[model samples]
Target chain A: MGILDTSPRVRAAALVAPPFLYALALLAFPLIAIIVISFWTQSGLALNRVFTLENYREIFSSPIYVWGNANRWGVLPLSLFVSATVTLVTVVLAYPIAYFVSFVVAPERKALWLFLITIPFWTSYLIRVFLWKVILGFNGVVNTGLQSLGVIEEPLSVLLYNLNSVIITLSHAYAVFAILPIYVALEKIDRSLLEASQDLGESRFSTFLRVTLPLSVPGIVGAVLIVFIPTIGDYVTPELMLGSGGRLMSNVIQTQFLQLNNWPLGAALSIITMLAVGIVSLVFILLNRRWLRGRA
Target chain B: MTYSPSAAPLIQLRDVHKHYGDYHALRGIDLEIKKGEFFSLLGPSGCGKTTLLRTIAGFEAPSSGSLTIDGRDMAGVAANHRPTNMVFQSYAIFPHLSVAENVGFGLRRDPRSKAEKARAVAESLEMVGLGGYGARAAHALSGGQRQRVALARALILKPKVLLLDEPLSALDKKMRETMQVELIKLQRNVGITFILVTHDQEEALIMSDRIAVMFEGNIAQMADPETMYRRPNSRRVAEFIGKMNLLPATAAMERNRIVVDVAGLGRGAIEPDQAPSGVQPGATTVGIRPETLSILFPGETTDRRLAAGTVDEVVYFGDMTYYDVRIPGVEQPLTISMKNLIGRPVLDVGAVTQVVWDERSLVVLSR
Candidate 1:
């Protein structure tokens, strides 16, 4: 009976309102607050409300006399490299597992297999990382086993407390995310296409090379994006398991906020890292699309 | 039929039975497809027509019996090594490749040079009437275009046999009809033995030179289109192929001509060949095709006998009208198809009409 009640625009707005309001309250507010704080000047023992670009200037350009040389090349790019490496390793390791579960495992057991894959998630994530630390520590199971086997006279110090350990820990932590997308992509492919390839006189390997591999690219790309974006900003894994040699972008930002007590510099660092990550991700996705389109 | 029976067999199956775990997919299939024949395995779903086709294509290995293709025993031969190509029901066109790449996919391991392979792909594409569409992505093509691409892709290998699993089923009605004729022409042009598996009896009749009608994993009747339509071996096959009016009758054999006492059309003598599976001593049924029975227009006369009936149902197609005429003693109405010629008028429902039928057109089926 009412005009607004019957209006499609009002109905659509009503449907969209909940998620939109939630996003505004949770995501946009913090992001805007950080951006605003990045421009405000903060002095020692007190906070100054003076608006200035000094925070951004310090983070973007090197103060030639700065004390910290570790981040002179910028922690964002190094953090990106670590995350990219972890994503590459995780995808390379996860792909075969995903392929095996999707194509090799029997249909009735598929749910059990997938459930097994997600079993690690039931435990707390921080506990999982510390478990990895225990597994790879200097006097950990691996080093102790090697020493007891007479392969080493003492426990080796090369296994933990480094970027390599962090990479291993992060890759293990994100295995499920990488496997799920690839499995879905592989599962979505029509089985008849494989039969068609075989009927067309292609060998098993050649069919995989020509048809199976190409069709599964979308899933692999999805896995890469899902694993890459979050691990770059992952603060806990590197913080608990690594020294400064493995410190990532989040660690640097955290130090600025907590220990150094420079909230403005921390906010500017966070914003710069977010922008760089966003731009790089956009470039990656665009390049993949163009390349995939051209190939197809 | 295009293929001469005396020609060397292209494919042969001897008691080919397939079982998928607990389900019997193919139960003792015995068939021989001659060279250059447009053969179709026609059946409803779950009748194992597709399973039989896959067995011939080497995608499925027969559980018990043996198969031979081109005089070679195909006992352990894998699908990739078999000299047979298939066009899937889904038209399984590779979505990630260009049209040219898809058409040339089978030539990847050929010893020929790049130029020769390219020429072969172009020629195959041209054969399917997709000549200049090589640079286009395969997934971007329309359904008809996709079927054409699938045909070209399968034919590029020049195999001894091409197994098509309902390739035109995905197309719209207009496209399906057009492709059916195109497919027949393509089969003749390539001169390769083509075995199509389809559930559409009309499609099977229109395209196949010879068809194998299967029911519950067994071939009910394998004959040329005309014979399959006119003289089906069983009542089930008769009803499956097209609308057949069946009347309960009593039959007794006298000499070569079997005397049948009918319920609707009156007693008459039918030829022994008309009783394909032999007439039983007890209850029997007589089948007549819709096109074989015609409704006589006012004042029209026929050399054949006549039966008076009332039109119970009238279904009008654009060029033809189907009239279900219930005769005096018949329980169900007999369907008579009348072509809507320029001057011939369409009959009305519940109208009194005279049905024209020939004794020779009746096929005696034993129950």
Candidate 2:
């Protein structure tokens, strides 16, 4: 009894209890409320609050629902596809930079290179995105440079107001999120392992393919999760820069609450989108664990 | 203790020198390692022993001179193309691979079937006494087992030479002693040139057939174990090898022989060969190992030179006892070890003692 009373476990629990309670009230309560509200119904401004499955039925059966849209063809799937593509491109682009930072830079200069990598983050994310908006917009940097060079007869309007521009902007905004984890994974590898591979008759390229690439999967998976999860539901980036044809699942969900005045439908759309993301994430983790844990 | 003269030299280094920016790592090293010889580069850390091993392994190229392995010049050859393999001091076992994969890592480019490669891995593992440990993760093994895995992996390729960098230093004393004997037997069984780099003097003495003792990027002395122990050429080499009590002496060459008078120990007439490096006029020293001088037992009759001393310090080991005796004229007390046999009394401090001296074992060194 004396040892138990003197132990730090009780004090640790007391210290952690505050943040745990805060998350419960702030995060968990709203999630549960969303699920509960998806099962309730609303009618015309003033209505009787009655529990029903109509909101889910409407989401599944109506043509105006996310999946039934003919041209956009389910903003849910489109958003998931866009986020996944951005994650892939960003990781492919940032891999070399992370590798260079971890291995190529001298030990004393590594801190300086990492600081340079993170310098873009000192500015606000919104401001960085807005700057990219200016660079990619019609009559922006690319069109102006091309026109002055006489390579283009007119300002290119196709560069902005498209899914390509939105993907580019999102990738730029989330570059730090992708680079840091990958850099950490690359840095965690021991130097002797690389030498051992070369000593065992592997070429530099094959050694990287077999050893360095396989061990960096955990970081790649981390970057994918970080970029994809938030980007799937990103409303502001699309609202500011996306063309009329580039509505994601979040835009329709926002419309349900603000214009449609149907909170139940909005909650239903959110629950559906969350389930899709969770399933995709779980599949990724299961595959990552199987491939990396078994081999690496 | 025997090196076969018929065995041809496998590695020849000629005036090899390596420099890193301002630091000279290896300075004009020239040596020849015979086929099937267990050679050692032994020194304290930063003596360029490891750099020399790396040069032989083709991981480092000498700055100016040339190195030839098995009669082929090794200039600009990568480690993968070289005929030598190294077991790193850290073992460098790939954690992500299995024991079998690690053992067969060098066989990836071999034009053999997978089954044949697997058999080779198994055979190498069994050779190192790690039989049937192929499927286990490399990171899961114990320290001794990891060392064995490293040995098996390096030896599996059957290179012309195998290099070990402080292989036994990571083990505890008992494990280290066991591995030392096992390593000697392994080298003999494999019958390749084994060059070990170690900072431990006793490990070098126990394991090497011939050792090149390095100091400050230069090989100070290269000799067989018995010669290194009995006849070190210089005072520095003698002190580095083991405990030696150096007595300031004056030597006079008379009739092709050197007559030396030690400060505390009496004079002796020694042959010319006893002074490996010819003794000169100025400050000369005669070295005697601790075991060469013994405290004669009471009532024992021996027709040998004797000295009188008082035991100044007593250190008792379970099997032997060391007595530090202060003779009248010696600057420092001479340490003598005696076996703790039955009925042989262990002397205490301040006890009067008789020391039996062997004049033939004395070495004249130039400091």
Candidate 3:
């Protein structure tokens, strides 16, 4: 007999089957195909169906490919480092704002502040990035104002086309994404818990650190994933702000896929990047679980 | 750790006024609670009982008056710094912690070592009758168990005062009764002042040494439970606290005495001493508790028995029988209750009976 022998069970399975099949076809099947192709080889001017490790060997053997691959490897750790820094800064900055909106602001005015925070995103993303570029450029507004104010005699060359500009632009763009989830988490927290903490003789700072921060971890995790995952795969902000020297893994994948026509190699690099991000996310989930269990 | 027998009032609120925008939440409340008395602020919803409790707990700042604890002014004291704790109505157990951690949360702030904190947590759990359940998560506990954990959390602090905001309202009837008895014993054991806010009059009368009845942002009366129930100062208090059958009456001064002619019961002279402060000679209202009225047999003396009424409905409540008597000329029928000692109901439906209550039971209030 099938597992759905009961009527209710069959009905439930029927209800769930469409979404499950769609996820398998759209998400799981493509991911598996990409992973399989990452290990295959392609011949000159045509596709090779043969399974081989030549692409992997080519990636590891040549000095330029090796250096470029090593540089690609640098994107993983560097992106993670940048993302972590941005996540920390975002959390620290967003918490008090979320706290104020949730606890202090009147219910009517809370929506206004939240709307103001989101208004920046109504403008075009490309325009916002370009605005940052104009502001941070060598002879842009910042330099012109600095020169006019006599802070420096000439425009500073290190202000644009660097890692600092990439981090700054990405952090500013993704801050709203981080704030919304954290604010939701803060709002869902029971006000009685805060009152209980106060009644139990905990100082406001202690209550926030011990109770509010820990309870809002789900929102923090969501914010971290939302900001970090996209920032890792982001090409536009870094491309616009960092110029050619500060290209990330996404830029390299774009070049290999479109410019060089090395479909298999680009696919391999894409799979590698996906695998790296997956591992980091899995580690975070496991760590969060362990911390929660330990606290419990 | 022993308090002096003649120790001063642990909590004192004088002319405390709390105004939220234009609405007055607490109006010029003055109260003093003794060191170890189990005091209750009892009222219906929105009558400022909870506001008064929160003000005493330092959660609110009284607008126009002084609040002191242990003879020290509590003007700028925050809730965390005050030597008091509260058991919230919702229990508010930290869902992320174990029962042990929830109980020991406040104690962990002390300079005690980890072992001392653990011991304190264990002791508190044991005191609340959850001796070996410290490792259980707070969410895993039942409602009554969560209430115990809340009480333990507040009591573990050993504060000078413990405030409870409708602590027993969430429990079922059986659990509520058991918790009331256990709380009284616990208060006696701890010997700390407990100020509770509750809308349940029976719960207040059962557990508190003194009860303050609040009405519309003001304390209408404060006295022992017996006096507050028997000699309520106003009609609102008599109606709000318990079951009272209020009958409209016309008062007249006759032979230097105030005589009130009730609608159903004929004219009876009210003792001038028992008349309320603002009683006029023309119109008034008289309050009588349901239990005070009794059905008299035919041969019984008719001295206090003034009227005959037909029984409209008889409600058998297992321990007592409530009879709704339909008396003539009264808009609302009067209720009378009799104890069901031998499983016998008080009166049959549609049966005519004489309703009698002693003169002392007739509490007259002026309109």
* Candidate 2: clashing pairs of residues: none
lDDT of 2 by residue, A119-207 (tens): 99899878877887788877788889899999999888877887888889888888889999999999998877777777777778888
How far in Å is the alpha carbon of B233 misplaced in model 1?
A: 0.8
Best by TM-score: 2
DockQ value of candidate 3? 0.57
DockQ, prediction 1: 0.65
Error of 2 at B211 (Å): 0.6
| Local accuracy of candidate 2 as per-residue lDDT tens digits, B1-367 | 2357467889999999999999999999999999989999999999999999988877788999988998999998888788888898889888778899889988988899999999999999999899999999888899999999999998888888989999999999999999999999988888888999999989999999999999999999999988988899999899999888888889987777788988877888887767898888656899999988999888787889899999999999989998899999987999888889898998879999788897797899975
Model 3: lDDT to the true structure: 0.84
The sequence of per-residue lDDT tens digits that candidate 1 reaches over residues B1-367 is 3567687788999999999999998999999999988899999999999999899888899999999999999999999999899989888888888999989988888999999999999999999999999999988899999988888988889999999998888889999989999888888777899999999999999999899999899998999998999889998999999888898988887775588887878778888888998887668899988998899998677788888999999999998999999999888889899999777888888789888888778888884
Candidate 2 wrongly placed segments (more than 4 Å):
A1-10, A46-48, A62-71, A294-296, B1-3
CAPRI accuracy category, model 3 = medium
Give the least accurate 10-residue stretch of model 3 chain A, judged by summed lDDT: A62-71
Model 1's TM-score against the true structure: 0.93
> All candidates' lDDT scores?
0.88, 0.87, 0.84
My TM-score estimates for the predictions, one after another, are 0.93, 0.95, 0.91
